[model samples]
Target: MTRSVYVTGIGRGDGRQVVELGMMELLTRQVDRVGLYRPLVHDTPDRIFELLRGRYRLTQDPATYFGMGYEEAAALQAEQGQDALTARLVEGYLRVAESYDTVLVLGSDFAATNLPAELGVNARLANECGASVLPVIGGRDQNAESVVAEVRNAHHAYTNLGCDVIAMVANRVDPDQLDSAADQLRRSLDVPVYVLPDEPALSAPTVRQIVQTLGAEVLLGDDAGLARDALDFVFGGAMLPTFLPALTPGCVVVTPGDRADLIIGALAAHSAGAPPIAGVLLTLGEKPGQDILRLADRLAPGTPVVAVPTGSFLTATELFGLDGKLGAGTPRKAETALGLFETGVDTTELTERLSVARSARVTPMMFEHALLERARTNKRRIVLPEGGEERILRAAEVLLRRGVCELTLLGEEDAVRKKAGDLGIGLDDPALDIVDPHTSPLRDRFAALYAKLRAHKGVSYELAYDVVADVSYFGTLMVQEGLADGMVSGAVHSTAATIRPAFEIIKTRPGAAIVSSVFFMCLADRVLVYGDCAVNPDPDAEQLADIAIQAAGTAARFDVQPRVAMLSYSTGTSGSGADVDKVRAATELVRQRRPDLLVEGPIQYDAAVSPVVAAAKLPGSAVAGRATVLVFPDLNTGNNTYKAVQRSAGAVAVGPVLQGLRKPVNDLSRGALVQDIVNTVAITAIQAQGDLR
Candidate 1:
């Protein structure tokens, strides 16, 4: 029988769509063909379903995804009483369950329905469909004790109705209260409980959502502006200087359209990137003059501006009622929601609870999901030296929003804020720490520490003071002094600049001869660990063996079972040379040191990974052609090979994650994208967890 999972909420504003979307993300990673079923939907189009279909490429018919419209279902329930409604929804769910390997059944919202008790209705549907229930309890304005009590009550409510409650989630609590809230919930409930802090971005109304809610006329803006989230609302009634300071990043400015001075001043501030507003709301049916509108257009080309007939007070009232939703136009919000859910929930345990088995194949999405889930465990703090860089700040936002780990961005505070403002990114979260390395109080302390560490090298405190002022050195000192667990740099600096401080101050780990790097090459169907690609020009026989051992440990740390393959020119004495001899010696050393490790060597790349080639070249050799971990002899070959495969084969290379370090410090390519930084940061956090134990 096909498995079904039901995601339902107890009340309104529970934000359960995050759970539903997150569950779908996990399901798709486990099963090849997953279907979606909505027991009851509003009369409007199912926005969340549309988003899932577009994102996951579901082949199920759009019409088949839903059972009945809200009015139709409520009428049936009122006429034929509850039995008719239950039968209709169960029929829709069974169809999807029969057609796909698994089905994600979205339950009804308690509010905006005619049913007497939506909770009871949802329980009956879950029980009738033979689905596992994930009950969501809202904790937006509740205390920790109250949230825990509500969750326990939810479990009783579901279980009393004979529904199999797989887990309970306490969502939308204050960020600072999450830890205490989660602790209480875990202690109170017997089943698995996950706690997600409130995300203001999800609750904030986007420009598009606001437009639809208010029926406002769009005077100016593009699609990108429409998607910008309005985090806060600022009323424009005071003088230009006073109002300008109130205009914040991602806020909608509400003012009279005739006040071109306030309008022009806001736009100018946005142009200067002081703090970019979401859009300007023209109240009282007022519209800007053609000349002023054109100036606003040139000031910020794509910034949104809408006009409504209602006054400021009424407009604010309606705006406050509107909340953002996860859908097709809001892909970024969807990503944020998914990250929050994955970070807070223990997905491995959740799968076990549901008895869902994941596929052996490791797709890129699955690998990315694992990276996020693993980083969340230890919650290490990572410092970024190039904090003011656009890509770094964006990555920092993603990291913090996902609750993956703590972050300290090192730079000039004012400059970083202005840059982030211009990009329309919000940095108001309390967990985010921004430090100016030059002006930080820790500068003198770090300088003293650096001088002492380098005293034998004739370094004085004064000279070390200047050295510690550099962002890279300051960040590295944080890792050395235990202020941060790791550091990720090289976004704006050379690789040498990024790692020079680590080698000088942090140094290598004990029982390790050298530091090397590996890239987790994410192919179409599998993830292969490629090592020593970015560091160490060449290694002797002993050093080569050490790299293999370190690389194997790193692979296993990330849940990738290790099968070590030492690469060289020859395959089992088929050829002989200086390179082949070194590889052969290294292979022997590995066999002696780690006898349990499956080892092969002086093997060609083809024979190491291709079963057909292994059958012909080195028959019956255990480690040939099925290796999960591939250790190259030198940097030149490994670097070129990983790059070739990454580009030619369309693989995602997630690394040069440094191995054999005392503390975790990773580097990024100067040309890295936003996602590249996110992946590397997550990897660094996971590496730090290993350091802790």
Candidate 2:
């Protein structure tokens, strides 16, 4: 039977997309095939459905998911009565449900639709579709008591109309009143209730939204800059001296294009990091001269500069009316929405209630989601050495917003703050700490500690003092000294620069013979662990065995069942060579040492992963075709293979996550994306949790 979850709001402005997107994420995590159905949609493109399709990578055709447009729905309900309308919607939903393990049903939006009593209609549709209802109530303007009453009323109305109300949500509630609202709902309602505090990021429109809504020409900014949420609108009227003080972070400055002084002044302020504006909007179809525009580009390279034909009054009218939407183009907003939903809702309980069967395969997104959820369970402090990098700053914002872990970004406090401000990252959160290793008092202490620890090898404290000032050494020392639980770096530095300090200070774990690394190669269907990919150019038989053991342990820790495969050029001793001999020897060593581990050796990649090849090459071997942990003979092989799979197969390679470290110190590629940093940070936090325990 296909389990259906219908996320419907009482009215518009409920921000129910958060609930809808959150449910989609949870569903994807649980099932391999999930479908989405919208009973009624506006004439315009369904933004929420598009977002789900893109974000979840749904393969269903758009036409199959939408039952009918609002006009068609209203016309049908009027002409043939509500029963015919309900039957048609149920027919569409059943078609979608037939092919999917689960279907997410979106109820009608009460936005200018002539449908009578939308709540009752939604209830009827949900009841007819056999979807458990997850009702969303708008609490934007409601007091705590009123919000509680609204939830009660919504839930009662749904139940009265023969809908199975599985849960209730009070969305966009005031942050300060969340606890009050939640408490009142708990006492007043019988079903589970979740309250999401109003997130300004979700509500604020992006520069792209502004461009599209006003049909403005993009005169500047990159896609990333345009994705920035405009938090406040600043109308440019005052002089530079007076207007500068009025500017706030993430504000979009609107003014006549002839006001070159204000435009340049705002861009200069943004460049200097006093306040980062989303973009500068030129009004009345007038723009500055080429010289001024050139200077503005230099002032803020990626800041959006757009021009509109309308005057300031009309532009402001459209800007004020524009609200942020979740769609194909707005990924940051999706992240923010998911973060808000995950934090506010009791997903475990909801999952149990939904009774979604778990999928056997773990996709890349599922792996990343698991990492975050595991990290958030017991939060740890992770130190990032590359604090000034834009990617690092953006990833930090995601980490903080998701409440994954506390972070200490190692850099000059002012410079870090300025950079974060320039990127529109909110640095005011207490979970974030900025440190300047050169000036911090801990620098001296760390230097002294380093000198003492390395006194046998080195002769001078002066050398250690200078070395500890570097962010990598500072972060590694923080991990060693227990100031931070883990460290993730190398975004803007070499891997050697990031991990060399770890070797010097943290050293290997107690039982480990050598430090090795594994890349969580996330393929389309499952996540496979590839060992010794980024470290150890070559290893002897003993070192190879140790790497295998460590890699297996790492795999087990991350919930990948350890069916060890010692990968080689040969399969099951079909060929003989120095490389195959080393792998065969390592396989024997692993079986002898672990005794309980499922180990197979001298296996080719195809034989290790493909059951068909395994049957022909190495039949009846427990670890041949079902291997989760693949240990390569050397770094030359492991590195090339992982890279080949990553590029050719479109796999998401998540690491070079160092194993056998005393404390968690993971290194990233210099070209790592913001999401890569986030995953590595989460991995480090989870490792820190194990270390702490």
Candidate 3:
């Protein structure tokens, strides 16, 4: 039977969607082909279903997952009986389950339907589908004791109905009460319980949501502007001075459309970014005249300005009632929700409890998710040298949003701030620090340290001062001085410039012969390691063996079991040449040094990766065709092969991750995308986790 999990809530406004989305994230991290099923939905399109399909790239037809609409479900229950309704729902669910390795079943929303005793109905569906129940309890307006009591009652209710209650989640608890509620539940409950505090971002209405709810016209703004979350509602009824003082960051200003002065002032404020408003909402169906609108456009281009037919009072009422939904349209909300869920829940233990077998094949998405989760376990501070670059700033926003690491961006504070403002990235976050390498007080100290380290080269204090002012050298010095755990740079610089400072300051590890690199080639089914792809040009036999050892160690650290394959043009003794001889020598050295490692050499690419080729040429060899780590004899072969496979096979090549450094310092391709920068930062953080220094 296919394993299934039912995420249900005891009452409305529990914010159970967070739990449901988090569960899907967890399932996808372990297995591919995970399915989603909604036992009952309202008449409209399911927002959460669309989100899952888009986010996870699910190809399954949406119709297959919906058991039935709530109206039909209610009619079936009322007319035929409860048993008849459940049987039909189970039949629909089973169809979805059979096609997937595991299925996540979303239970009915209690507020949507007029069906009575919704909890009992959900329990019956879970029991009939043979699914484990993960119940959610709302702690929005309740005290710590009430939250605890509610969880206890919910656990018993599900168990009494013969539903296998795997765990319980209490969401939207007050931050102050989170600890108390969690401790009480831990002592009282037999099973595990997770608590998530209320997040304002998840609840704040977006400009798009307001426009949709009010039936307003978008006279101005783009998709980016409409996506801004409205954290506050500022009514612009007073004069410019009073209204300007009341304006807050992420606020939506509501005023009569004829009030052109207030509109221009608000747009000017948003342009200056003193406190960026989410948008401006004009009431009474009035729009600013062409001249005023043209001026407003100059002040803040693409800033959202909408018009609604309703008056100011009615608009305020509607705005206050509207809340954001965690759906396909709101990606920022999804990130915030995932961050909250991952931080509060013990997902490792929860997954173990589910007893879902881990798939042997690791997809690209699965590998990326594992990197993030592992990095978060021991958060490290990483310095980015190219802080002024656009891609770096965007990647920093994503990293901070996901709670990935502490970042110190090296650039002039004023310039970086202006650029971030232009990109609409908030720079006031506590986890991020912007530094000017030239004017910082630490520059003198760093220069002194550098002079001492390079004293034998006859480098004077003045020369050292100039050298430390370079961003790459400054960031590398931070890592060497233990001020930062790792560093990721080279988005705008060459690989040589990024690591040359490391070569001078950090040096190699104790037992390492030379610093090498590897590219984690994320293919469709699994991830393979390709070494010396971005570092060495033409390493000797001894250096080749060392690279193999380092690559294997790197693979093992990331949970990819190491099976070393030394690639050459020849398969075993089929050919004779200097290249084959070099590979054969390296293979012998690896076996002699680390006898425990499974290694094969002088193997062609096809024989190394293809089972049929291995069966014909090198039968029964441990690492013949099952190689997870491929060590190239030279950089020319490694680099070209990785690029070919990446382009031809549609693989995601992450790295040129520098191995054997004393402290972690990785380089990004100058043409790296935003996601590539994010991945490199995460990899650097994870590498820092193992450093005892």
Candidate 4:
């Protein structure tokens, strides 16, 4: 049985981060699963949802799991009184508790000694969920009396409500006062008391962290200001074909001179449209050409454009390294990135760290409509290739009703509808589109193109048609032609089979030498990206260089700065071989082609990942031991190696996240699990939103 815990106390002054971190720690202790429920969040403008989405990367919205909107939930909290709120909260908690072995109940910020009416609600909820409550106290000022009062209140609430009190955590305590606070608090409370230290500014989120983790140099803008409050970084344009993902919007590093076309293109593609520019650092210290100046004037007129003396745009990257402004700013994404990197935290670790705990005894409920509504509001789009398989249909139906995406299933409308109905999957809405490959306008176009291209190859028209009719081909075509923003296939195909069509029909973006695959490995503390795993069998030096470049770019797309490490069996010049030679050559190529990229190669895996190993193997290398992107020499090494790490090292593999396509299109293994499908869709949606440039 999976050990399960419930997390409450979200939205109570750092309560969210506290509960999230606590749950993550618990998960590392071999817990089977950890779940969080926000039963009674205040009615705000999707702040809770945004928090969940941005901080935790949760795909399911609050409404879906709780059967209440943020507004409705807030209203219920006020009108229904504590008893009613507790009942509703408990009902939801129990619904999620059935799947786990043990559930950890998170407490709210309201005092345990609140009015009897309010106490009853919390107590009742805990009892119904069959969860033992763990009071997580967020110590804002660390007052002894206040702390004691909070604990006593919690104890009374739990006892009166007929629930067990397992433990109590005093979160975010000042280091100097931690001992006294813990001692005083423990003496007053019956539960075990744990004091969590106040994290340093280094522990806080900042842009410097993001930049260093990605191995990207700060091109322009005030690093201090950017470190604080920069939300999304937008990277796009014709230059996007050559643009690195390392420059997200809050940092707004411009391609020197009059590359306003790039900026305009990126702005047009942004989901929220373009955010106000933080600042623009002109690359190469060049003035905008007349056309570019005109475009910039029309688009972002007052945005400051800082100039550096670097002659070439690429040379401007050196400014980031020279700035020496790593630790400045509040709400700094860079700082967050650095803190995350320093602790070696990957995406999985971060996600786990942010998960909340729930109770095991509660009966889990499926609030399909709520989930669907949230997905719809988020404008998520999930693709289902036409075959009308029962599993696919059922999955699609559940996802659709829950508002996961604008569902696109490939097949004749009649057949798809029949299959859906037969499978008990409802699809009576206009949002669902059914396309028959044989009759699709795009398919016909592909057929014509293929026939013309292969006419002299002795391939019959029928054969050409058959090849173009493959779902993978059609799906790639959808992404290429903008019919769909992204695709998820591989349920009935091999990786090669899924990818071959993309390679042939979709083609690489101009200047991209090879298409590569990256695996977003989610570990306990951080996300480590492995690349060239699914594509590029035995990449040459040039190909390896492109893989490194593309892999780094991909990291940036996901808000991760690329710290590229060109991996080989040897460290530095320790070994001599075609493989090592290729790595060394590729490393140089990356330095030459993208001088801004922090890349080093001819390094062993251990040296690339472990600081100790890196120090011993290659003392002076910048990327040694700190590399975020690992480029393998061949498929044999990249594929087998990453799989071995996934199984043995216990990393949650998130992708074969395909990169370098004109749009966001990825293939799945034929036997992809449901969760795999869900994650792929999420990743695709994110990519689609950013693919506008």
Candidate 5:
């Protein structure tokens, strides 16, 4: 049975799409494939559906995404009956449910529809589909008493009609009334009642929404400003000095177009970052002169500036009435909605209540999402030595924006800041630490420590001083000295140059002979581990067995269970060679030492992973056809095979993760992308969890 959760609303203005988006997020985190269905919708295009489809990678047919248009449903109800409407909805839902593990059903909006008893209609459809209903009650502009009353009514109405009401949400409540409403609703309802405080940023209109609303002319700025949320409007009626103090971040400027002084002042304030204004609005259908317009562009190159034909009064009235919805354009709002939902609600508890079965196989997305969640749970500081690189800066922006971890970038401070500025990346905030290795206060201390550690080799502080100036060396010292939890580098350096410092200083972990590396080859449906790819060139039986054991532990760390495959040219003694003999010895050693592991050796590639080949060759062997960890005999074979599979299958390979290291220090490819950096950083953070001092 496909477990489905139906999010229905009572009347409109409830902002129920947040619940739908939140539910999609919750479901996708637990499963690989999730389908979306709307029982009823308007004839116009659905912005929420578009957002969900693009964001969640949903590929279900767009036609099957909805049961019927509102006009068609209402007409059917008037002509045939309510049973006809329910049956058609059930048919549409079953089609979608057959394709995915879970289905998220969106109930109809209460907008100019002719259906009888709109709320009751939603209840009947939920019953027909056998889905648990989560009704969202609108609390905006309502007192605590009314909010509590409506919560009780929505819960009773759904349960009384035989619909399984699993949870209730009271959204858009006034900030002052939030505590009282939450208290009253929680006491009144048996299920969970998550309350979301009213956010002006969600209701406040963006520059793009303003353009679409007033049909305004674009005088300046770009999409960045267009998507910016205008939280408040600052009417430019005062002089430059007095008005600059009134400016606020994410506020829109409203003034007469002839008032070039106000416009220039607001733009200057925004450029200074005292508070970055969202955009400027010109009223009375007047635009600034060409010279002033050029100045405006120079001040803040993409800050939105729009002009309207109406006066400021009427524009403000419409702007205040505008309430933004989650869509493809407003990703920031999606982030806001998700943050609010996550902060206020206990999703784990709610998920247990819903009781969707977890998938046995781990998808790449699930693994990646799990890594991020783990990192965020206990955020550790990660240092990027390639701070001057563009990809690192871009990844830093994403990491900080998602609140993933704390970062301290190592380089020449001025050069790093300039490169980040040139790429249009923001690194000026205090949360980020941009350090110049040459002038760092910790440089002397690190040099002394390095010299002390290498005194047996006749190394002095002078030699250690020069080496500490290198970014990779400095970053490694930071990790060793407890300044940073972990380090991710190699965007422009070699792999040996990246990890060589750790081998010298941090050393290997206890009870481990060699440091092995693994690449997480994320295929389309599942994640597989390919180990010893970049570290060992050639290994005897003992070293190969040790590598296999270390690689297995790394696989389990990332939640990919271990079923080891020692790859070679021969299969079950079919062929004999030195390489095959070595693999056979290593497989036997692993079985002898750790008998709990699933071991298969001298297995060809096809025999290892293909069911048909395994049945013909190694029948009924558990690890023959279903291997999660593939261990190559040598670096020559492992490196080439991993690259070939990556390019041919179009898989994302996150790797060269060094196992058996005392401290966590990972290397990146010289050509890593922004997302690759993010993933590597996340992996590094997880690796540092046990060693946090």
Candidate 6:
């Protein structure tokens, strides 16, 4: 099954960039598909879809994705009664829900008021679609009660409408207040509550905003005079043609005199019932030739054109770069979606506190004392793949500046230096090693491993070099060959691209049979472990047992007890099938293999999750409910279910911390946002420290 999560409520000014960035974060955790659905979008089209479609290459259509099929519900509200409009909205939402695994229903701007009725509509739709409703409340203030009330109201509406309440997310909360607000909501609400921190990293510059930031004025006709913001700016003469379709209203065309024809033609096409051209800023102090001017006049008469005194288009690009206005503040809707993912909400802690429950297993140490001691005393080698990139450089700089660990970047010295120079970043430190894959002594070792793995399949040494040159494989080989303490990749690659090479070269830990993943969910009050979402699909009992053990180990590493809950569709003897049987057998195997483990299985998610539900399901079962580590039977069930809980239940999901590698190594998705990369790096660092133990 294709892994998917549905997202909605995207058409507002609260910066959907974070949503896009956040969704990219989810993608790294191995979710194959992400669907956006806005059941009742306003009459005005949301520009995010256009931006995402063009810039991010998102294939889903914005019109249909948002569920605004020609007639918008807001438009219907004026003609029909509110109830009728609500029904239409609900119908649209239901249609979207059927196509995706987890549906993220966005509340309108008037969620404080309109949500009461809208929530009912969504609840009915959720029930019909068997989807979870994650209410994402976008706000600027830290009024805990108001936020809690909004969440509760949505939950109440959904519950009253005969749907389950999953979670509530407080979007755009100030960083300082994020913890407090999350805490307040967690205490007040029965379900999980997450506060998405306001991260400026995800915001991309709008063309209008970019123009304004550069101190350029717009002069194109009426629409040009109208204030518009550019979603992003494109550079290079070669890219101008490709970027034209991505141009929205208020897009300022910045180009050189040599490309006047290109600029004029693009502007003409854009102004023809197009969104609107913010204006054109001619670079290189060159005016259009007579022929170009005549064409511009005929195509877009009176279009405002500004000329910069810069010597060349490249210089103008550099100017924008120097000002930090080059695609830096543009909002990415995907990041906003990711920020909506409920993390840092301690659902287990809350559940235990609310129900006065105790875990069957003893709590672990606050910190891994032995590991911390080892990290403090030893010089640990950390490998970062695609080290030539700006983000990785910045991360490495951070680690170096803080004296955290020794950093190694995988790249050729000259190319890395050149790229670093282009970005105006200099790394002069001797501690940082720029290892060229071709020249490194360890290259032979990696080549040998590559040959050993592929030789049986008719791959030769020469072929192995080309394949292993991919940093994912190269970096994994570094760990396998004991050249690095840990390896971190995936920023420039997919999960498969990152992990497959590792699986082939490094293989799993000696005793571990299958590789799996677990996210250490950090909430305001506590942390819960969610597993098998990042790796493994349709895991049998043995694989499930392995996941359970790994999740428990991860929980322990993070200072939490391992009260493992093997999640299934049924609770105890209530349901029977291969899926339930897998969970039950896994539970039995976990007990047999590791009697020290406290585990329960063949349990419904709620029963495995809630103490109240657990008590009701099995009166005296030892591990009936207070389980901290949730081990899913398969990727399909784990990924979709976790996202449902993350988005709808308001649980902040943190990881798919890749486990079972010989050394701690993890991957990042190619489109992962900065914060996600930062967090993954931090997690990888911590995991590296864990290996010292």
lDDT of 4 at 148: 56
Q: How accurate is candidate 2 locally (lDDT)?
A: 0.90
Tens-place lDDT per residue, model 1, 67-117, is 998889889998998998899889988888888878899999887788888
Question: Clash number for every model?
Answer: 1, 0, 0, 56, 0, 53
User: Considering every candidate listed, which one attains the maximal lDDT?
Assistant: 3
lDDT tens digits, residues 472-560, model 5? 88999999989999999999999999999888888988867888889999887788899889989998888899888888888888888
TM-score of 3: 0.93
Model 6 Cα lDDT, one tens digit per residue, 624-658:
76777888888888888777876675654555688
For model 4, residues 1-693, the per-residue Cα lDDT tens digits are 323344443224434344444343334333334445545444433343344334333434345345343455456667876556666666766665565444444444353323335445545666666555555555656665666566566566666667665555566566677777777866776556566655533233234444444343443334333343323333333455555434443344445455765655443322122223344444454665566545554543333344444554344344333322222133222223222322222324323433434332211111111222233445645566735765566556445433456778887766665444322233555667878887877766777776665677776667877877777777766766667777877777687877776776677778788778898876655567899888778888998898889888888766456889888888887899887898899999999999888888888889988999888888877888888788888999999998898889877777788888767677776666655665666666766666421
The residue ranges of model 5 lying beyond 4 angstroms of the native Cα positions read 43-45, 141-146, 174-180, 219-225, 255-268, 284-299, 306-311, 376-379, 384-451, 454-475, 489-501, 534-543, 576-593, 634-636, 670-675, 691-693
Please name the candidate that would achieve the greatest TM-score relative to the true structure.
Answer: 2
Provide the overall lDDT of each model, using Cα atoms, as 2-decimal numbers: 0.89, 0.90, 0.91, 0.58, 0.85, 0.60
- Per-candidate TM-score against the hidden true structure: 0.83, 0.96, 0.93, 0.49, 0.86, 0.48
Better of 2 and 3 by TM-score: 2
Model 1 residue 317 CA deviation in Å: 5.3
Q: lDDT by residue for model 2 over 26-69, one digit each (tens)?
A: 88878889999998888546788788888777889888988888
lDDT of 4 at 310: 55
Ranking by TM-score: 2, 3, 5, 1, 4, 6
The weakest ten consecutive residues by lDDT in model 6 span 362-371
- Model 1: lowest-lDDT 10 consecutive positions: 417-426
Q: Any runs in candidate 2 off by more than 4 Å, and if so which? A: 284-286
RMSD of 4: 24.8
Q: In model 4, where do residues sit more than 4 Å from their true spots? A: 1-382, 394-404, 412-415, 439-446, 449-467
